[model samples]
Target: MMGRLTIRDRSLLRDGVKAIVSGDVEHLKQIVLTMGVHSGRIDHARLYGDIDDFLAKYAKLDLGSMDLGQIIEELVGLAREHRISVPKGISMLSRGVLTLEGVLAVVSPKINLLEILANRMSAEIRKDFDWIEEQKGRFRNLYESSQKGIRIPAQMSDLLRMALKGQAKVNLEVIGSEQPLASLDRMVNRLVKCILCAAMLLGSCLLCTTGMQPKLLGIPLVGMLGFIAALLMGIWVLWDMHKHK
Candidate 1:
């Protein structure tokens, strides 16, 4: 069930939760600032209940907690697994709590949520280092290889350009592939051509062949006619393929 929060409070909480989810440190700082400044003047019990209801309402997915004990446990667990430490914002319990740390209790399972998040943020740095090492290994292999080979296909280049342009759907009048990224591309093109060609061939054969009755499409003597007759007989095949495509 949803909590009985006022619209203004709900808006504040929604924005607050979004800031937490996005790990917006600056916004959290403001929340902490506002809360800390009013901490002494606020009704502590009511404020605590509000927090409890908020957690229960928000934590539909994760180890969402309504209690400080659960929040601490989750954070502690993450820390042990990832070898991460809590920030100074959460270190002093006697002090007014940091807004970011309050957000952390919801995001992380007690032990190392902050640490994991920090690691994720710096992943690009790690990726760059790893990429350099991999390139060095690739360079050494390329130089050592007996035969040097390279592939530069204009058709493939066009496809790559189309993909980068965010065209997930493609339609080609005719397909002529110099290079293929995957067998599926060739397979699809081949299937298309084969279907068209087969339809043509079937119609051609019906010219010499005679006396096959036209049942469904209501045409006269089937095999006596050419392409139209064959196509009429197997129009459903083309239709089904078209539907799937």
Candidate 2:
């Protein structure tokens, strides 16, 4: 006696066939979506045009029968034509173990153009895989919900508290003082002034001892000239100091 297939058996058979037939199409759609997202501002015309062109070119060929490597290579070439950059590591990976969600996880460590592609791919994968929803719920419960009340270590907690309370102090002490340089500068200035004064005084005394015949207002002309030069030098030094200040 021939037995008729039950509704459950028919449904299982239909799902199996649908999965097989739609696998390549789903993957291609995911790749296109990822590229659009990564490109930031999607050019809808370019995107749709490319997909339509690809479909038309490969319409005669069974996409499911094509190896994943070849498919990825074609996709990479397409992305390059459109100015999209795919990671070298991702392109090099074998297709047998690669999944849209797996690729997303591998590349989504940071927020970047690549991350946008990863997220888009992940969304596409989720659309195909209903089980991901259940997994996401469990992950959120274990990580997101629980993380809110996570306890910090005592040392770290105390440090954070101190910072929040504005009680944290950073003491910075200079290793050496600049007083020595200032003292040396003052000593040098005084020594220069004393040398100039002594030179002027000695010259004036020598001129006076010589008792030159030429006199200026009853003063020895040479001695008087030396005194005038000394006064000018003092004025110059004071002017220089004031100018600098």
Among all candidates shown, the one with the greatest TM-score: 2
In the range 18-94, model 1's lDDT, one tens digit per residue, is: 45455554553344334232313333333434444434443563423233333434433333333334333333321
Q: Please give the CA lDDT of all the candidate structures.
A: 0.48, 0.58
TM-score each candidate: 0.18, 0.26
Tell me the lDDT of candidate 1: 0.48
Top model number, lDDT? 2
Relative to the unseen true structure, what is the C-alpha lDDT of residue 165 in candidate 1, on a scale of 0 to 100? 93
* Residue 146 lDDT (model 1): 28
lDDT (tens digit, per residue) of candidate 2 on 1-245 = 12344555444333322333344444454455543325544444565566556655555655333334444566667766766665544354424224543564478623233234345555766787768788988998989756665654666799889999999999984433345677679668866985796699689878887768798876698899888888887787777566755
Superposed Cα deviation of residue 53, candidate 2 (Å): 1.9
Off by over 4 Å in 2: 1-30, 33-41, 63-65, 94-245
What is the TM-score of candidate 1?
0.18
